[model samples]
Target: MLWVKAFHIVFVASWFAGLFYLPRIFVNLSMVPPESVAERARLLLMARKLFRFTSVLAAPALALGLWLWLGYGIGRAPGNGWMHAKLAIVVLVLGYHHACGVLLRRFESGVRQRNHLWYRWFNEVPVVLLVAAVVLVVVKPF
Candidate 1:
């Protein structure tokens, strides 16, 4: 179980790395001038690669997380309200991840309607989710 926990932590960290960096890429991409063809291409390549890698990490992280939950019945057990809240946050995180993918596609399609400022704010979404998730899991306030 400790090993599982450790691996889960590793994969989650990797996933968060992607969630963090990809948006920053978007921020840069958002600002790339239309004349800067080379810069746009480079940024697009980076975004595509990071998105794919992060997605791979997400799968194992999610699977291990679920294993921890269902294997020990942590979420199903009583007084596990914290676990429920954490799961809810995780779902939102997944939704955010999906949104990032969609945004990447839109960017690839040359849709830069949203400015760098928008992506700068958008990038904070996962950070908040991470902080909230850590607090819920550690404090178990509920």
Candidate 2:
């Protein structure tokens, strides 16, 4: 149980780290002036590298999380409200994570003319989702 809890903490923290860093990357990318092709390339390269590393972290984080849940959670606490809510939020977070990947690829593909403002607005989604996730985990509001 202790090991499972530890893995939960570690992986959840890593997931949050990725969540935080991704938005900052978008902000940086959005700020790059139109004329600085070289600078844009550098920023894009950095973003790609960061996302790649985060993607690597995400896989293990997700795996360990699932292992912990299946191995420790399901039978241990029957009809757990918070756990159920957290699991649902996890799905939403995963969806957002995949969306970020699509956006990353779009950015990589030189597909300009996207609604930058809309993408910037979309950055808030994860923040709200993360907050809800934390609340579900910590507050356990049943």
Candidate 3:
């Protein structure tokens, strides 16, 4: 169980790295001038690879987290409201990950519906989510 927890922490941190970076790539992608075809292609390739790797990391992270929660009953006891809160944040993180994929698709399809400023703002979302998740887990301030 200790090993599981350690691995879970590692994978979670790795996944969060992707969550933090992919949007920054989007910011760069959005700012790429129309004439910079080579640059756009390069950023798209990086974003695509990062998204795939991040998704792979997310699988182990989620599986290990579920193991800790259900198999080991880490937070199954009564009044463990912090776990529930953390779960909600996890759901939001998943949604955010999906949104990144959608945005990437939009970029791939040559649809520049959003500007760089929007992506700059988007990049901060995972940071806040991570902070909230850490607080819920460590502080358990419910």
RMSD of each: 0.8, 2.2, 0.5
Q: What's the count of clashing pairs in each model shown?
A: 0, 0, 0
lDDT of 2 by residue, 6-75 (tens): 8767777777677667756766666667898988798788778877777787787778777877876642
Using TM-score, rank the candidates from best to worst: 3, 1, 2
- 1-142 in candidate 3: lDDT tens per residue? 9999999999999999999999999999999999999999999999999999999999999999999999999988998999999999999999999999999999999999989899999999999999999999999887
- Tens digit per residue, CA lDDT, model 1, 55-142: 9999999999989888956567788799988999999999999999999999999987798999999999999999999999788898
lDDT of 2 at 98: 83
Each model's TM-score? 0.97, 0.83, 0.99
Regarding TM-score, does 1 or 3 come out ahead?
3
The model with the greatest TM-score is: 3
User: In lDDT terms, how accurate is model 3?
Assistant: 0.97
Q: Candidate 3: which pairs clash?
A: none
Candidate 1 vs 2: which has more lDDT: 1
